[model samples]
Target: MAKKKSDGVNKSQAIRDYYAANPKAKPMEVAEAMKAQGINVTAQFVSTVKSNSKKSKTTRGRASAKKSVAKKPAKRATRASKATSEVSLDSLLNAKKLVEEMGGVEGARNALSVLEQLMD
Candidate 1:
């Protein structure tokens, strides 16, 4: 079967209607919808149209940053958070010193011996 070429209109009226009914939809979504409905618009064409529509709407509009304030945290864990899994030598040293001042070397050794157990 042969695919008929579009008549080379500036804007496909069907696509405009589809977008009007589904405002805020992505270009890919429109492309998929057109494909499923057996229309001939390409994904690139849909994307281009969507971008043009957005550009026209925002020609005199304020910058997007002025509309909303958003703070999105990084998705990956940081080095400091991973440090939680490893016991700090400084913490262990402080604990040992406290124990020894209260008693003696034996108390310090006891504290060091139980460091792993205490960390858990």
Candidate 2:
């Protein structure tokens, strides 16, 4: 169906204006008031506008910040778990063999200290 032309007045805006004037007004009351002013709006539409306005006011930037902060911790945990899982048994065995070839863990540490000095 073709859209009906607006009578130059927005129904949702009318509902919001009425709600702004009467913050404690019920949806049915707002609907009745709008009907008296020749704006055809339902109580459900008024309720939806009121709720959406409240949600917009409450969640402006805080909600997005909260979501980003929450996601970072979960991503960090995923990265930590991935790092631990990537250390395979074969890699561990190779590391052990290297330590033994260096004579032991203490000897490996000493050798690493010497290698670090050489790299510098």
Candidate 3:
């Protein structure tokens, strides 16, 4: 078996570089330029590289959006923690007494739900 020739050249990078320098260049033009530079590539391969680069950029945009959304949850959690810290122990004890009077936590929640509906 014969080993495939390895010229140590990255054809995809070369194609991408050529396209970056010549943004309006066609796929065939990029292929021809790479062939001149000793990296044999087809126009189809160049087109594939361009399409893959565009997809990667779009995916990066979505990844950044997801990161921003993830940060929002952290901020909300911090605000919730601050709000919880602001609740006095007396208020918590009173709420506990109220829950016991209502018979249990579930009964208190049901009474609150009814109160909420009446308020609406």
Candidate 4:
């Protein structure tokens, strides 16, 4: 098993070295290149690191210009909604009974929790 390398390489170096010998290449392509050269890296990791660096700059560019934005408050569910959400005792009992029939105690407990949350 290979020990993981340091994540200390800045995005500039990573991205530059990645596409230096393989320009116009994608992140997955870069990851494969890293693997070929024996650098422990994943495609997702490459994409994430590259995007993370760009994200700050991208956010800054948008910050200078105003955009229509509103934070919508979460609404409390109505009594009717709550009534409909009530967990049926019969359903829970049936789930428990089925789990017991299948010799699945753990499954019964999991199902019971779902039922309990609904009941609350």
| TM-score winner, 3 or 4 | 3
Error of 4 at 73 (Å): 19
Instruction: Give per-model TM-scores.
Output: 0.35, 0.49, 0.44, 0.34
Clashes of 4: 0
Score each candidate by Cα lDDT. Answer: 0.66, 0.76, 0.75, 0.64
Error of 4 at 23 (Å): 4.7
Cα TM-score of candidate 4: 0.34
Q: Across residues 4-94, which tens digit of lDDT does each residue of candidate 2 receive? A: 8857988888888888889999999999999999988889989898988887454575244343443221111222245465765555666
Q: What is the lDDT of residue 44 in candidate 1?
A: 87
Tens-place lDDT per residue, model 3, 9-58, is 87778877887899999999998888887788899999999988777454
Residue 65 C-alpha lDDT in model 3: 42
Best by lDDT: 2
Clashes of 1: 0
RMSD of each: 19.6, 17.3, 18.3, 13.6
Candidate 1: give the clashing pairs.
none
